[model samples]
Target chain A: MSEEKKIIICRCNDVTLEEIEALIDQGITDIETIKRLLRIGMGPCQGRTCLPMVISIIARKTGKSPDEIKLPATRIPVRPVPAGVLVGEIDEE
Target chain B: MKNRAEVIVIGGGSTGTSIAYHLAKLGVDVVLVEKGYLGSGSTFRCATGIRQQFTDEANIKLMRYNVERWKKLSEELEYDVNFKQTGYLFLATTEEEVEAFKENIKLHNKFGVPTRLITPEEAKEIVPPLNADEFLAGQWNPTDGKANPFKTVFAFARKAKELGAEIYEYTEITGIIVENKEIKGVKTNRGTIKADVVVNAANAWAPILNEMAGLDREFIPIKPFKHQLVKTEPLKEGQIEPLVCPPAWNDSYVLQDGEDGGVLCGTGLEYGPTYDMTPTYEFLREVLKWATRIIPALKYAHIIRQWAGFYAKTPDSNPAIGKINYIDGFYIAAGFSGHGFMMAPGVGEAMAELIVKGKSHVPLDWEWYDPHRFERGELRSTAFQIG
Candidate 1:
């Protein structure tokens, strides 16, 4: 482990594997709490890229199965939408 | 889990965690229980702006102390809470708004808060892309700032735990045990925790617990109002440093968050005592409409996420922060309408002070925040509220 290079887990927020593992060791099991603390899942991708890996890591570390781990609720506008487009810009004649 | 503690704090949001931390710091044994993860409630969902520019002197004074506590919070917790005092700009678009802000500035100044009325040009300088034509004047208070909502609450919980406070997350309080009008303990899903003093710091969910503690319907008028916010994909930092609020336009506001440069904006408070956390399309569209109006350049910005949270409002938007008159060991530190995150540190300090030492050094009319104030028809308007 000491010889290994620092591994990044959440690419959008640049959160690391070590960081996630560290908080897990501190007895923080919930991904939601971890996400808030590190802002890992709150990026442009909205945890889509990082959550699976983080969950697996959490499950492996905490001795909980993947099924037992709580998943964050996938919020709306699943794909990113431009702010201007949402502002009734598309005129309805 | 400890079966007995001197104090039991329900809810683990900003206020609850801070109250627990402050209590523990004062040598009181505190146990904090949360139904979900800490700060996952309104604390995480609310907009990230702490301001002292209020129309009411009491609120202005309370917020002044809250800002001071937030400044020291990072150092005090030995954790970087990312507290930055970028200041908050409340814009005045109409003559009535300008006149109202002028009065608010005077009141703010009286409390040693250096809030000043600035020209629209100065406001545009602060938030460069600000629609200069809309506002005639702005109230800028340099000390009003924001800290990381998540970090702030978690730091408090961590420090409180370090100080021998027991923090139980995922432990839902099933019932409150009261014997002879005194709080005996709380019944949680896990088990019973015997605490003499029970604090209903549960925010929007506080009324339920108040009812469990035998509070009559009349006493438990605390309701939740739905408020919504949207965050754009990381925009450039420094473009919008201050929280630019236009009270004239449905209390709409926009500010760039420091965490990832996402421009967070709000359409303002909704009027229902709503429990629904569903992010509405109408809310998103309205926020986009008003936020772009505030800064025309933001039209191109991409929205990454939208969320809804409750205000857990009282008869007044202000919170009930002291001991309940009827119940012996029952206290309240919740119901901060929309300003709970900003007010948590001060609430914690004041609530702890009230419990341990019988008084708080922080200057506020204590009776104003009392839980029983509603009975006397003493509901005062929340400062700087547009509607």
Candidate 2:
């Protein structure tokens, strides 16, 4: 189970459990702050891949429930949309 | 932490970083603080449309100067900003809009913008995929272009740092210390920095910073509206000619990104003032509805991502620049209403001149953008504002 400490949590941004622990050691407890510092959830998936893992990591590190730690603000287009589709290009069936 | 700087510019977005770069170039001890990483605010999410096609003479002139600077920006910053002068095409569907565009073209021409009112046929020549039947006339400016916002902000920040300006990211400004209406310093979560000059280039958060300075009622409130934009998968290079804007179609505009060839698009739909950066499914539907009609080829492209950013809007869409009379050395370079990213270079140059020489060397009428304009009821609004 010691290997889990070095396991990658955010595959999109290449964030790992050890990296999150390093940031938490620097007094960065908030999920949003941790996200900003480590780019934990700012990747293509917009935290979908790593947010749950990060919340659990934070919860375990600070000895608190995952519900106690506030979730980061959810922003637009929930899924990754191509740049071309943004201007007018829609996927034609 | 050095704990002191001659000038503390809050918010390390396009505006703040530009100001810091310019001030540092002029040998001012400037310190820039950002709550998040650089360009993490509206800068990262901006549509990156750079245009000089404005109805008002002031805005036209301001953007004209900005576009000129943009032309040489990459060379000056020693970075490829991906500035493509693909031109901005404004399609006028109604006769009234066409007539309004003719007047705007005249104003643009007077300011050396080189904008011309072209026939529908000519518009199609510029953008081959444009549906000529949809519009009566088109206002085309060949010089107006788009820049890579991320690269541009980093270029400025890098140059500023190289010139001895200190930038602190992940630092949130909590309070402003003003003694007897004179500028003293600012209190950040990190520590209090004693600064004689403080410029609130915080965009959407400018009003809160203003309130912290004890000048709550002095400046007009800058409300932030969630402006959403979507990017499609990379298309073939040179497939689209320029930024195709159909103002009549809910102010929707589309352009191909020069760096990645992705079709970047947005609309001017008013979502009111909110901090919600969540992109709505409705926005995607609405933007596509008009966009597909304008360029039928776009219907085949797949949307890759959608994101929302804030447009710090004032009562008048124009930004508030210059120092307030009440607060000594407390300056403002915000409230751009989505145009801040495009006007960053011009605003940075002008603000630096104002700070160093006590007046703007640029020909722009800085008084029109004074923070007290709302109180004096001298609000000057621009007619053409693309989302």
lDDT of 2 by residue, B271-301 (tens): 8788877678888888777777888777666
Task: Estimate the overall C-alpha local distance difference test score of candidate 2.
Answer: 0.83
Model 1: per-residue Cα lDDT over B251-274, one tens digit each: 888888878889989877575777
Off by over 4 Å in 1: A1-4, A90-93, B269-271
Tens digits of per-residue lDDT, candidate 2, A32-86, equal 6577556566555768889998999889989999998777776555666543455
Strongest candidate by lDDT: 1
lDDT of 2 at A33: 51
Which CAPRI tier for candidate 1? Answer: medium
**Candidate 2: stretches off by over 4 Å:** A1-93
Task: Give chain A TM for each model in order.
Answer: 0.86, 0.86
DockQ of 2: 0.21
Each model's DockQ? 0.73, 0.21
Per-model TM against the reference: 0.96, 0.84
